[model samples]
Target: MSTRTPLDVFLSDQALAEAREQAKIPGTLAIAITPAAPGTQCSWCDCDIALNETEHRCKGCPNPAAVIMHQFRHGSPVRVDVPLCTGCHPDAARFVLALAQAGGTR
Candidate 1:
């Protein structure tokens, strides 16, 4: 039989509890970025969520706190409630490139 020290057991339990707590948080949804014109899918995921050429970022994405505060006064660039999935978000360089091609921004 294997033996686990008391400290190890306690640490394991603590980790499990922390994981459970984190699991309760809901995951974000994904959105696609397409061209301003019609008849095409998002340049990244091809989901057909494009809006316009000047607009960037997903419609309802959770932006940084500072950005939110600044943009709050002026209102949001895009007022839609649809957010892009984390995978398709314009976070990575490659993803940003694809989004830019589709008229989206990073």
Candidate 2:
């Protein structure tokens, strides 16, 4: 069993909300963000290239040109967001568009 303290057990919702809000404010606290290792590959096509903020290619063909979020609903709603390379992004977009038009989800 885990030991619990009164301070931990009695955390208020407002306190939690305030803490979350503070975390979003830049320079509220000092924190270091580590960059990805050199030779990091694009998430979509596994191309060994420098990636931008979204972990996709920064340049060249087959690079990620777009990031898309797809919402799926079967019984419960689900969301999927991914970066796609230029070659695959168009096809994926078309498929998602078609699915939305058909009012279907999987």
Candidate 3:
């Protein structure tokens, strides 16, 4: 369990810088924060979740309710937002583009 409250956390300067650098092409990077601490990875996708969003959600999430609706849906643990350094991945472009179209940033 995390002791920090939602309001107690904000993007750190170092993290923001790192995210910016990894983001490449300004404005394409947005953090998917969660209420829990960092270092936890998604059980289903094996993605590391960054604790940045209020609900800890990431972009391009295929099933918004998959993680929230049930703890162990269909025998597989729900996958929540995971910390990702995937800016250079093949699908990163599409994901970033989508966020951009959605008005990046919460």
Top candidate by TM-score: 2
Find the candidate with the highest lDDT and give its number. Answer: 2
| Residue 26 error, candidate 1, Å | 0.3
Q: If scored against the real structure, what TM-score would every candidate get?
A: 0.25, 0.31, 0.22
Report every candidate's CA lDDT: 0.34, 0.40, 0.37
lDDT of 3 by residue, 4-58 (tens): 5545455443444454454454434434333334433323332466656457544
Weakest lDDT window of 10 consecutive positions for candidate 2: 29-38
TM-score of 2: 0.31
The C-alpha stretches of model 1 lying farther than 4 A from their native spots are 28-106
- Model 3, which residues run further than 4 Å from truth? 1-15, 18-81, 84-89, 104-106
**C-alpha displacement of 12 in model 2, angstroms?**
30
Ranking by lDDT: 2, 3, 1
RMSD of each: 16.8, 16.1, 14.8
